[model samples]
Target: MKILLTGISGQVGWELQRSLMSLGNVIYMGRNQLDLSQPDTITTTIRDIKPDLIVNPAAYTAVDKAESEIDLAMAINGVAPGIIAEEAKRLNAAIIHYSTDYVFDGNQNTPYRESDLTNPQNVYGKTKLVGEEAISSIGVNHIIFRTSWVYGLRGKNFLLTMQKLAREREEIKVVDDQIGSPTWSRMIAEITAQIVAKFQQNPSDFFSNKGGIYNLSPSGKTSWYGFAKAIFNDDFSNNERKLQRLIPITTQEYPTPASRPAFSLLDNQKLSDTFGLKIPEWDQALKLVLDS
Candidate 1:
């Protein structure tokens, strides 16, 4: 099978290169090759490749910057998926796209479900939701895996930011109000490959029954401060860094251009029940990321 994978330079996309190798010939494309910002180029590139399955991990992922760049964000995150979905439908191919937990307003006391009413609080979230709607409305075999608090060894993420800050600064202040599971990007890609393998093995029944959205995140939730503490304490379990302090602060104290969800945790029971897959706990996953 031929698979067209976008966003190969990104955190999830970078790991997908290794995880998806066994599945098929992955035609990976980074920004220079498959720019989601350019709609016509997106269609042209997908058509040119004519992949059996299109896996889009690309998006306008700058949460704060998106507040000022609405049009660009929408073009990439909102409009691109529909265009790709239409092309996929034309070729009778399947699509697997990644989404964010920010699609919800994040006010719910419990973990957000796939069927929850979406009320995005920021432009980034709003655009991502638009992408989800676009693909769903296009009537193609698709799987929207909405994940949260994604971090990895590579890329600009909370884990890397903390590692940098801890070394340079003596004290680190993290927002404690916002809460979500810190899912490793590698796990997301591997799980997706497993899903794709299943579909390739049984296309008719999988799409006929299981073609829709699913929450793909780690098992538990934690505040930014909690995650930072884990990073420091775990990473420095043997070695040394700043060897310093962590101050937990409220969201109001640290304001950003884009408003984030207070609690963006997602329930992954649906994904687990459907795929018989489960990510390790937040702390355990962090240890794994740090160790290997």
Candidate 2:
């Protein structure tokens, strides 16, 4: 099988390079090769590749910056996905897209199910939701995996930010009120590969039955403060720590351009039931990443 993977420089995409090779001949594209913001470029590139499977991990992920760069964000995160889906439909190829937990407002206290109503609180979430809707509306063979609090060794995520601040500052203040799972990008890639393997086994059956949105995240959840503590606690690195204290603060104390959901924990029951995959806990996944 010939597979086209986007966002080679991203955390998930970087890891996907390693995981997806076993399934097929993977043609990976970084931002320079296939810019999602350019509609004609996206069309031309995908048409040239003519892949049987298109896995899109590329997205405009700057939450705060998206507030100012509305058009760029919408183009990459919103409009680009629809364009990709259209091309995939033309080729009769399957798509695996990544989405976020921010699609829903944090009104409910319980973990969010796949069937829950979405009410994005910020521009980033709104754009991601648009992407998800576009993929679904295209009526293509697709799986929209809604993940949360994604971090890996290579990306500028919360885990790396906390590690950097730990070295530079004595005290680190993190928001404790906002809660979600801290998923390792590698795990996301591996799970995606497994899904693709299943699709490979019986493409038509899988597409006809299991082609929709599924919450793909670790089993447990935590606040930013808790995640920081966990990172420091599992300090497997050789570098010396300069952090004296890790302080917990509320969301109001630390203001940002984007309005974050207070709780965005996604329920993985649907994904588990459908895929027969046992997901690791958030802390366990964090340990595996830190150890690596």
Please report the candidate that would top TM-score against the real structure. 2
lDDT of 2 by residue, 53-128 (tens): 9999999999999999999999999999999999999999989999999999998899999999999999999999
lDDT, model 1, position 210:
89
Which RMSD values do the candidates have, in order? 1.3, 1.5
* lDDT of the candidates, in the order given: 0.91, 0.94
Please, what are the lDDT tens digits per residue for candidate 1 over residues 29-114? 99999899888998888889999899999988999999999999999999999999999999999999999999999889999999
Model 1, residue 171: distance off in Å is 0.6
Model 2 root mean square deviation, Cα atoms: 1.5
In candidate 2, position 63 carries an lDDT of 96
**Cand. 2 TM to true fold:** 0.98
